[model samples]
Target: MWPFTKRPKDPVLDPSYGDPHRKALIRALEKRKWKFARELLNMAADPDEMAFLMEAVGGVDGIQDWIGDWMDAEPESTLPVLVAGCHAVRWAWEARGGKRAKYTTAAQFKGFHERLRHAEALLQRVLAREPDNVTARAWLVTSSRGLGVGPAEARQRFEAVTRLHPGHLVAHEQRLQYLCAKWSGSHEEMFDFARGAATAAGPNSLLHELVAVAHIEKWDATEREEGNEYIVSDEVRAELLTAAEDSIFHPDYVPAGPGWAPRVATFAMAFELADEFDAAGHAFALLDGLVTEWPWQILGDPVEKFTASRDWVTTNRS
Candidate 1:
C-alpha cells in the first residue's frame, strides 16, 4: 500500500468549481489531443453549458499556439474558430492586465486593442456562419469594451444574444461588466441594469444573484468604511435576501454543473458583508467548503477570505 499523504487544509478556490469535464478537456489539450476537446464542446447540453466550457478553454494558457491546428483540421466546424476567438478576447485582457488605464503602459493598451480587433474578426467569421451563436456573440460583447465600441454598439451585440437565449447567464454577466462604472456607465446605470435583469430572469434563475454582484461592485468602488456601511444597510440587506430567495433559496432552484459555485459565493459574500451571520452560515453550508475567486478575491486572498468568513459565520451565527 502507498503512504497516506495528507493534503493541505486550504479551501480550493476554483472559478470552474473543479468540474470534471473542464478537467478532462484541459488534460486533453495539454496532451495536444484536440479531438477530445472537440468532443467535449460538441457534447455540451445547451448554449450556457457550451459557453461555460468554452470559457474554460479560452483561459488555458498558450492555447493560441496550437488551436490553429484544430481550426485547420476541422474547416467545416465552427467550434475551433469559436474556441480560438474566445481565447483571443481573453488574451486581449491578458495584454491589458487588470490594473487601471493610468497604471498600464502605452504598449499594453496598444496590444490590448489589437488583440480585441483580432478577436472580433474571428468571432465575426463564426457569427457569419452561425448567426444565432450565443457564445461568439457573448465574447463580442467583451471585445466591444476593450475596443471602445460605443455603448450603442455594445447594447446591440448584447441584444442579439438575448434575442436568441434570453436567460443567458454568461452574456448577462458580460453585459453587467459593460454597464459598470469603470466602463461606460455610472453606479446608477449598473444598479439599474442589475435589478432589471434579475427581475426579468425571475425565480430559480441565477441572474437574480446579479443584484448581489451590483452591491459588491458599488462597495468595491466606495471608500472602505463607507462601503461596509452601504453593504450592511437595511435596504441593501433586504434586497439581497429577496434576490437570494428568488434564486438560490427557492424551492425549485437547482445548482447547475460548474456554474453553481459562483452564484452561491456571491450570496455568501453579500450576507457576510451585511453581517447577517445566520444567512451567511446558511450560504456557506450550501457551499460546503467550495469557493469562487471573485467577490472574495476582491477583498483579499480567496482562500483566506473564504476561510475567515466561514469561521466568522460559524463563531457568530445564532
Candidate 2:
C-alpha cells in the first residue's frame, strides 16, 4: 500500500545512507552546539551511535553511564558500546591530528583541549582493559609529553614501551634523546649506553651525533694550549666520521627514514671539525639536494642552513 504490492526499501531512509549519526554528533560538537547535538543523540536509533555520542560529550563519565544503563537493559551486549566509545575517543583525537595541536582559532584550541582530555581518559580505559597494550602505552607516552607532563613520567612511559616492545624505534629514539639531554652520568657511562642503543637499534643517526658531542665534551675537558682551537682528537673525530658515513648507507636508511638527513648533517659537522672544506662542501651539496628532493621529510631546515653557511665559510677561508 505504501508504494507497490511489495514496497521497495528506501535507500535514503536506511541507517547507512548519510554519515553515521554518531559522526554527525561529533561534527556538531566540534562546531560547539552541545545542546542540539545532545537532542539529536537522544533521537539516534542505533545503540552504537548513542554510545559514541555519550562518550564524545562526557568522556569516562558518559562511558560509565552507558555501561550502567546497558547492563540493566541488555547485560549480554554492553561491552561493544564500551569498546565503541574507546574507539570514538581515539578517532576524535586522531582526527584532530594525533597528539599535536593545530589550532588556528581560540575556538579550535578550546575544542582541542577538550578532545585531549577525552583522549587521555580513553587511553586510561584501554590500559585498564589490557594493561600490556604496547600501542596504547606508546600513545599514552606521546599524550603525556604533549600535555607537558614531567620528564620522569615520560621516561617511565618510554621505558614501559621498550619493555613491552623492545624494537620500537620511536620509543628508543626518544629515550636516547632523553638520556642525552639529562646526562648526569660519567662520560664513559653515557658513551656505553649510547653505543649499546645504537647497536641495538641498528645505526641511529642521533647516536652518532651524541657520540660526536661526547668527544667534543671530552676535548673541552682536556688541556688546550693558548690560542689553539680545542678540536676533538683526530682518533675520536675519525671514529665519529666513520659512524656518520655508515649511517647514510645503512640498511635502514630509506629515503624519508630516521638516518638520512641527520647522517648527512653529522657528516657535514665532522668534515667541518676536520677542516676538510671540500668534503664539507660536498656534504652540504648532498644536504641541499635532500632538501629539494625530500623537502617535507627534512626535520630541521635551520640545521641545514647552518651547515650550508659553515661550508661557505670554510670554502671562502681556504
Candidate 3:
C-alpha cells in the first residue's frame, strides 16, 4: 500500500457505513422531505456529517434536479445552493486520486477537475448573492481542495468562514485536507494548523479532533516505517492524550450523535496502528459499534479495517 498499489477499491464511502440514523436519513430524502433534510444538515455538529449529508442528497447526477425548482420558488433559499455545491465537492473528492494517483485514469482526473469547477461556480454564485453565508464559504474550502489550490488561498477561505463561525468543525476538517502534505503542503504546516485550530476552539470543543487529524497527515507524509514511528512516537502520543483530556476524555464529554463518531475513529485507528491498544480501546468504547467511512476507509475496506484493528486491540485487552 505504501509505494502505491495497482488494484484500487472501496465501493462506497457512505458515511452511513455503521450508523442507524442514516438509514432513516435516506428515507427522508427519498420522500422529498426537504424541510427535514434541511434540519438534519443544520444539526450536523461537524464537517464529516455536512459532507455526508450533502453527498447523500445530491452526489448523483439526477437527484439535484429538484434544487433548481426549489431555488426558483425561494430565491433566498441558500439550502439548495448548499446541497448542490457541497455535492459537487463530494463528487469531485470521490473521483480524486490517492497516493500518487494510483488507479486514476486521465479521464477520471479530468472529470474530478470538472466537478471542482462546477462546485466553485455554484459556491461563487451563492457568495455573490448572499456574500456572508459561512456554509458556502466552508464548501468553498472543499472545492478549493479539489481545484488543487495552494495553502494560502485555502487558509484565506478557512479564515473567512471561521471568522464568522468559530469552531466550524466541517471547515476545520476541510482545512486539514487543504494543509496535508499530499496537497502541496508539508507536515509542519499541517501540524501547525491542527494545533492552532484545536487551541483556538478552546476546551471541550470538538476542535481537538484535529490533533488526531494531524497525526493521520503526519503518517501520510512519511514512509510507511517512518510514518508508523511518527504516529506512535512519544511526541505525537502525548499530544493525542492532551487532546483527549481537553475534550474527549474530559469529565464533561458529550456525544453529538453518529455524526461525531469519525473523531473517535481517527484516534482509534491511530492508536491501533501505533500499537497502542489501550488508547485504541478507549476510542472503541466511545465508538460503541458506530463508525464513519473516513480516515479509516482512506486505507481500504473500512469495516474490515476497523474490525481488524478493533479485534487486535480487544485481544490485547483480554
Candidate 4:
C-alpha cells in the first residue's frame, strides 16, 4: 500500500538540516547582501563547515545571476568565485534535468555541458590563485564527472582534496557518486569503494554511512521484490548493524556539522527497509522531528516516507 494517502502535519524539511546559521546566510544572499555571506564564509570554523556553507549558497535558485555583483565587489577574494563556480555546477545539472540520458533532450545536454564548462573555468581560476582550496577542489571532483573527464582524472581531482583533508565528507560523498554503477563504475566498484572508505576512516566518523549508501544505490537499481529481498537479507542486515555500531551508535560519535542529519536519516531509511525496526527507531529518535529531502525523496514524499517509517518503527520495534 502507498503510504502517503493521508497526511499529518508536515515534518521540518530543512535542506540545511543541522546548521543553525544557514538561514542567516541564505537570507543575506536572497537580499543580495553578498558581504554578509562573505563574512559567514570567512568565519567558518573549519573546512567541513566552509564546504557546507558554500553548498548551501550554491543551491539557491538564480544565485548565478546576482553572484557576479559579489565577484565585482571583492575582486581579490576567492570566496565569491567559489560560490559562483559551485552554483554554476548546480545550474548545469538543473539544465540537464533529473532524467536519465535517454529521457533528456539534446539541447538540454548542450546547455548542461556549456554551464559545466563555465563552472570548470571558474573553479580552475580559484585553484590557480589558491591551490590548497579543498572546497574548490571537491566541487571540481563533481564537475569532472559531469564533464566526462573519465575515471583517472576524476580520481585525481578527488585525491587532490583527500591528500589535504583525508576525512573531507563532501569530497568523499561526491567521489562515491562518481563511483556508482549508474555513473562511471559498476556495483562491485561502488561497494568496494564504500566498504574500504568506511573501514579506513576513523572510528565514529560518518563514513560508515557510505556502506548504507552503497546498499541503497543497489536497492534503487534492482526490481522491487528482489530489491526488498536483498535489503532485508541477513547479510545486509548484519552489515548495516555493524555500520551503525561503528558510526552513529559509537559512544564517541558526534554529529558532523550540517551533514549529520541526512546521514542519520539515510541509515534510518535503510534500517526500516531492512526490517530492523529497533535500529530505525533509534535513528529517528536522534532526528527528533527534523528531516532532510534526499534518500527519502527517492521513495516518494520525503516527509511522508520519513513519518511513515518513523511511525512504523515506533509501533513495531521490540
Candidate 5:
C-alpha cells in the first residue's frame, strides 16, 4: 500500500514509527483546533513538511469520513476543503499503478481512478467556493497527474496555483512528478523545473528540495547500471551541494516545529544516494531517530533500510 495503514498500535508498536509531526496533526484534528491546525500547517515551507501533513491526514482511510464532520463544524473554513482534497488525492496516489510494481489488480486501478476523480471534484468545489485556496489547487494538480491528465495540463494547473500562492512546495513537487519521463515528462524538463523553482523560491527555503528529488527520480528512470553512476556526475553533484547550502545548511534554516524532521530525512537520503555519508550524517542528526516511510521505502523496508544506512554512516564517520 502506497499510503500504508497508520503505524499499527498493536503487537508492540515500534517506537520508531511514532512520528511527532504526524501525532501533532492528529491531535489538532481530534481537539478540533481548526485554526491552530491550519496555522501550524501553513508554517510548512518545504515539500517534506507539506508531505508529512498531507500524508498524516490523507494516508488513513478514515480521514475522508472525518472531513464531513469537520465541514459540518466549520462550514466556512477553507481548512476542511484542503484536507478533503488532500486526503482524496493522497489516497488515490496509493491506488494508482506504476511500472515499479510487478502487478496491480484492475480493481485496484479502478479504485485509484475513482478516488482520483473524487479528489478532482472536491478540489474543483473548493476552488469554486474559495477561489483563492492554493492548497486546494495544489491537490487538484496532484489529482490531475494521478488521473493521467497529461503533463502540459498538469503544468497549467500547477502554474495556476502558484500564481495565487507562489513557492508552494507541494505544487512544485507534484509538477515534478507530472514531468517525469516515466509519466511522459523528459529528464531535461524535470531538472529545469527543479532548478528554476529553487532559484525562484530563493535561499533558506525548502524549494531547493526539488533538486534532490529530481536527481533521485531521474536516476530511477534510467538503466540501473548507468543510473548508478548518475549521482557521480559533476553536474548532479554540484546541484545537490548547492541545494544543501541554500536550504538545510543555510543559517536561517528553520525546522518549523516538528515538521523539520522530514526535511532532514529527505536531505540525508539524497546525500546517501550520492555517496556523501558525511553530508548524510548531518541530515540524519537532525532526524534523531524518527524516520519516515518515504525516501527510504523508495528502496525497501523503510525502518530497516534507514537504520542500516544510519549505522553505515555512523561507522564511517568514526
Candidate 6:
C-alpha cells in the first residue's frame, strides 16, 4: 500500500546495507584470512566494494593499482581512495625496514628515492585540499625525509606537522634526526636531543644508539675518558655488549649502507665501556661485510677503504 512513497530501494539491496559480504570480507582480513577475502572480493557485485575488499587483502601495490584504475575512470572523484593508496605504499616501504634496504646498485637507490617523492607529492596535493589533515601532513614529512631532503626542508615540514598536531611522535623523531645531522660534531646538542627523545619515546633501541653515537663521536675526536663515560651508562653498556655479540654471530642488525655505521658505532661504544673482546670483534666483522657488499664504484673506493680501515683499527686497538 505504501509502495509509491516507500524508499526507492529496499534497504537490504542498498550498498550501504550491513553489506554482510563486506563485513565478512573485513573480518576475514582482520583475521589475516587473505585467501578467503581475496576470493570473496573477486566475486562481489559492487565495484567499490570489490575495491575495498581487494585493498584489505592485497597489500600496497595492489591498492595503488586498483585506485589508479578508479581514478582513470572517475577523475573528478574525491581523493579518499588515492590517500589510502598512498598510505598502503608508505606502509609497505616501512615494513621493508625504514631506510635500510640492501640495494644492489645506485639505480635502485634512485628508483626508491623517486617512489618516495611521488608518494610525498600525492600527499601534498591531498593536504592542499584538506588543510586540517594531520595524517597526510605527517606522511608528507616522513616521505620527504625518506627521499633525503635536506635537513632545513625536512625540519620545516616537521615543524608544520607539530604545529598542526603537537603530540606527533614521528615528527619529533625526524626532528631529532635532523638535529643530529645538522650538528654532527656537537655532542652536547645531540645528547640532549637523544635524552629528550628517550624520555618521551621510552627506551627505544634507536634512541639509545643515537646517544651512544654522540658519545663515541666525541671520544673518537678528543680521545677523552669523559666522552666515553657520558655515552654508555653501565647498565646500557652491558646490554649493548650482549647485543653486539649476538649481532656479530647472527647479524640480526646488519642494515645496509649508511645504516650500518650507526649500529657499528653503537657496538663500539658498548665494547669500550664493557671491554668485551667478542663484541669488538663482531663490530669489525660486520663492517667488513658492509664494505664487501657495498658498491665501491658508486660509493667511492676512498670512502669504503676509510670505513673498512677505521673499523679495523677501532676493533683491534680498543
- Quantify all predictions' global Cα lDDT against the true fold: 0.85, 0.48, 0.73, 0.86, 0.72, 0.48
Clash pairs, model 5 backbone? none
Q: Which candidate model has the greater TM-score, 2 or 4? A: 4
Tell me how many clashing residue pairs each candidate has: 0, 0, 1, 0, 0, 0
Q: How does each model score on TM-score? A: 0.93, 0.43, 0.84, 0.94, 0.82, 0.42
User: In model 3, where do residues sit more than 4 Å from their true spots?
Assistant: 1-24, 31-62, 72-76, 97-99
Model 3 scores a TM of 0.84
lDDT per residue, candidate 1, 152-247, as tens digits?
899999999999989888888888888888877889988999999987887988999899999988888889999999999999999999998899
- Using TM-score as the measure, name the better of candidate 4 and candidate 5: 4
Winner of 1 and 3 under lDDT = 1
Instruction: Give candidate 1 misplaced runs (Cα > 4 Å).
Output: 1-10
Highest TM-score model number: 4
Candidate order (TM-score):
4, 1, 3, 5, 2, 6
Candidate with the greatest lDDT versus the true structure: 4
Q: Pick out the ten consecutive residues of candidate 4 with the lowest summed lDDT.
A: 1-10
RMSD in order of candidates: 4.8, 17.4, 6.5, 3.8, 6.5, 18.3
lDDT of 5 by residue, 50-102 (tens): 65577566655556666787678888866677788788877776776443534
Model 1 deviation from the true structure expressed as Cα RMSD, one decimal place: 4.8
Question: Residue pairs in steric clash, candidate 1?
Answer: none
Residue-level lDDT of model 3, residues 1-318, one tens digit each, is 011122223323445645555655566667766667667777776654565566455434444556676567667877777677877777676666454566678888898998889888888888887887777898898788777786678879999988887777888888888778777577788888889988887888778989888887778767899888777788878888888778777778776544567787887887787777777778777776655677676688777787777778877753
